[model samples]
Target: MLTQEQISAYNEDGYVKIEGLFTPDEVEELGSEMIKIIGDWGEETIGWRGPWREKYLAEDEQQATKAVLMHNPHFYSATWGHVMFNEKLVGCVQDLIGSSVQWHHTVLHAKPPERGTPFPMHQDYPFYPHDGLDFVDCLLHLDDTPLESGSLCVVPGSHKDGGLEHIMGPDTAPHLPTDVYHPDKVESIPIPAKAGDVIFFSYCTIHWSNVNRTDKWRRSVRFGYHDSAMRPVGRYEDKVESIPIPAKAGDVIFFSYCTIHWSNVNRTDKWRRSVRFGYHDSAMRPVGRYEDDPYRIDPNNVLEGNTNTIVSGYKTNSEAN
Candidate 1:
């Protein structure tokens, strides 16, 4: 159960880190399980793009390893409605989002050293069709995460606001215009953790991470949950779809669909492994495509034109520019 102080902190800052939430032994077991899964997928490239396309078929073993890491097994018996829905986790989620939360999805992010890339700032719900309101996310750490390694950075209270407009950049969103968002911003707070520690934040919270400059690899497992009332924006893809993975250890970061978040690249010479899960409010309703409504601003992205911005240290990826 969460203490009054913990609850208060969450309410005030929009996020909280619970230390020593999981034992070292548990972290190790989960890591080993991930390694086994990666091995099973064989040598293949991993990421949003296809791993075994014609160009990558002849790459070295390292390239193959990268490919295989992205081929996560969504229905793996290890995660199938079991480990993710355990009583302890569920109970805590119930406390935050109410007893009616439902499972949404899961993702396993594995970043090999010198291979992971930086993830830009963006809201999780923007990609989905759900309405942005009253949702929560739970992130579980499976390894020790430090500043040198990639750790999550969040803008306290950004969630209470709404989404910001993003100008696409050359490498990211080249066609977009500049002078899109207003200036003064909030700073992002870095939340580091050891194995077993969990961090929970709302979907509307704005957050990002830094690159792993250390030689040691960083890894984590994240699970997201939301109110069931949110409608699905598109087809139900695998819970563990490929996005930019994080490079750190014992870092579990979860959020709701409406939450704004991102991660950094792994420049160090190590492997970053993490798993992720998504859930929804049991009472959420389905909404169709969000693009149709021009007057309706996505609460998750309300910071676009505001000059006084919070969490200004981290920038969105080039695509989000």
Candidate 2:
């Protein structure tokens, strides 16, 4: 589905653009179906509405925030659902993250000519906070997006910084402070894309867009897919530092269940055995069961109706829903 080189690029740079991910026919279908699903709305009904509007625009250019947008297009059109379920796209994503990924949400961002909105630097973590860094957003372009036509710009390798602080309060959209991280202020790169191309980017990467100065509409459909087995840091705070503790046999490690942690894949064909169990205080009561619960899945036993001499700790997150 994806080359190892492509996967490596995403791991190192936080983003990768795949050209011709969809065919020309597929792109046309998406654009036409989107029109049908939205129908027609008066100009007054459309515009970007975020508190950062004033900080990024002038009195005259305030209307530039008049970008067109909608959420969950798949809810309205089966065509979108079909595209979301594209086999190559999903398999490529699995190659990067893991075997299991879930749909977080979908969005339609249609930038109108001249008055299209500009998204300031921001990390998507604030919009949909999750437990792991395996969360990825896929953008399907239906128009040729040049730098001036709100092409996405990203800070390379920034996801390694993990989540960053954003201005979040009542009635405000979460975004980085303009004074510190606007396009002109931050180190960035514009990702110009052709119709039918798809851009896969991490949720933690700092991203923003320019206004659509072109005459045509810059349309894109975005689907957010996340690994069910996500592992990341902070309840709501940005990452500070990471420490790796290498161990040998006979080593014991202890950590809070709340900590977002994962073990490297077992590379050997032979069994890599370990005994894992959790202990809690007598006063504590269990309310939720996670994916790796011992009670739900006995590590020592083979799957139901199967015979196995050794227990292989391979996991799969393969679900259409």
Candidate 3:
């Protein structure tokens, strides 16, 4: 439900792709409730508990669930807080962050099979910074991301060069300076997506991903939205070409938060899942790390409420799960 040339191609090529919204039985009941919270044909059927508890292990548990990465599964799945309050993705977040929207928190990048993991190229305001970029990352691709199975890559406008300063290499987290992606300074585009597609972007857009050399297993879920009045322009900077639009599954991508993206590494054997969730703008307020758990997936506070109200001090790796 957006067109003015898709809002002027998300304001001069930032990002935009909306095709199926969510059907196929709501993307097969949100991929069978994320395979019962990432059990993937093994065990761990739901019993959802989070707080990242050492990524939940009870033994080998398939080698501790391939280093599980599941933060805020709607705070322990009420079928993922009912698919993270999807009313056509909050009416496209009130048509791109306008009327009352707050509820920022949701992650479930469950990249399993063939041990998936390879997100570099950084910029989400250095781990969710805020204030001026007005945040908005809604990447839910739940599978069919090809490019040898690791699809998603960009550099189009490069968010007009904003946030580009992430040091310390080899993904111990803080990243960016890989000589600022030297392909003669930058030009990487591999945006393949399917299975319930959704790829909105920003957070000063520079993106990354690689290493799924597919054998089956690729998941996504990044829903994060903002604009209530914006806050947290703290600063710490660093930061697409190529928009291969071929959506299917449940298409919906709307970029802005400083667009520049990345993804590639699923060497295919099949299996790529995803499901992320987030929204905020209900008169803003609660800054940094959502000011102590300010979870609010609207629908009148979906699964519960937490308009915490803490102004600064941050921390969110799903608040350690």
Candidate 4:
């Protein structure tokens, strides 16, 4: 459990480094388990293929893709599960959480020496959004992390700033705007930790790391947890699969509002338009009353009669057709 002073630090700083949270033997065991598990399931090329590399790195000709990562190790090995639920670790989590907690997920973010990648300044909240702010992640260090070795750093107390907009794109992971939150401009605190140390921080905390210049592996496993009552708000990319419809000009496409759907962006000169109409069962009560929906037709866009009718062109069609 955290001491009063440590608790105060966490409360004020939105994070606190718990030195030697695990023993040396435990850290060594984690390292071994990771190696073995990685041998079983191949690691992924997790290096950012973006401008952050060019902006941060020292222009080394021989910098092989910077990092390797494995996700949800506990699903494959019992050792990870054991360590994830260890009494001491859970106790400290409970200390800050102040109630029953639920295990969210875990990931192993290990950076190899020389070209270990640097993460751009951003909050983890975008990656895993929740309704409440009690969600916290513990970065359990498995190897010594110094400033030169891409140690974790943060804009301390930034969690109190609440969630900020991230520069989300298809090419890159969610990060803060390059011009606004660049590492050179943002004031941050470097958190160099030993093998057994763990840094527990709120998900809203703005954090980033630099390229590992030292010739040693900077290995760490992150375990996230939240209050049992907390609810998650998932991003569309995280849960949805996009499949486009092969609709012709006159074809009408329809689907339930609950269905997850998306459309391809228009790139041609043709003005692709949609006239939508909605209906619901009268017996089924609405969760809330809504007004001023986009269902209305635009008067300016219409040529003459700004009719809301679906078949405005089909005026008085006879039975003979």
* Local distance difference test, each candidate: 0.55, 0.78, 0.60, 0.81
Q: What value of lDDT does candidate 3 attain over all alpha carbons?
A: 0.60
User: How many collisions between residues are there in candidate 4?
Assistant: 0
- Runs off by more than 4 Å, candidate 3: 7-9, 12-20, 41-67, 70-138, 141-158, 175-199, 202-321
Candidate 2 backbone collisions, by pair: 100-317, 132-231
Worst 10 residues of 2 by lDDT: 312-321
Model 4: pairs clashing at backbone N, Cα or C within 3 Å: none
- Judging by TM-score, tell me the better candidate of 3 and 4: 4
Clashes of each: 82, 2, 55, 0
Q: Write the per-residue lDDT of candidate 2 for residues 123-179, one digit (tens) a residue.
A: 998888777788999988999998889899999999999888998876666899878
Error of 2 at 69 (Å): 1.3
RMSD of each: 21.7, 15.8, 25.4, 13.8
Tens-digit lDDT string for candidate 1 (1-100) = 7777877777777788878766777667766776666677534433323321222123443233231233223444354235466676666667776678
TM-score of 3: 0.26
Model 3 Cα displacement at 273 (Å)? 25
Question: What lDDT does candidate 1 reach at residue 247?
Answer: 38
Q: Candidate 2 — which residues are off by over 4 angstroms?
A: 40-47, 231-321
By the lDDT metric, which is better: model 1 or model 4?
A: 4
Q: Order of all candidates by TM-score, from best down to worst?
A: 4, 2, 1, 3
Error of model 2, residue 21, in angstroms: 0.5
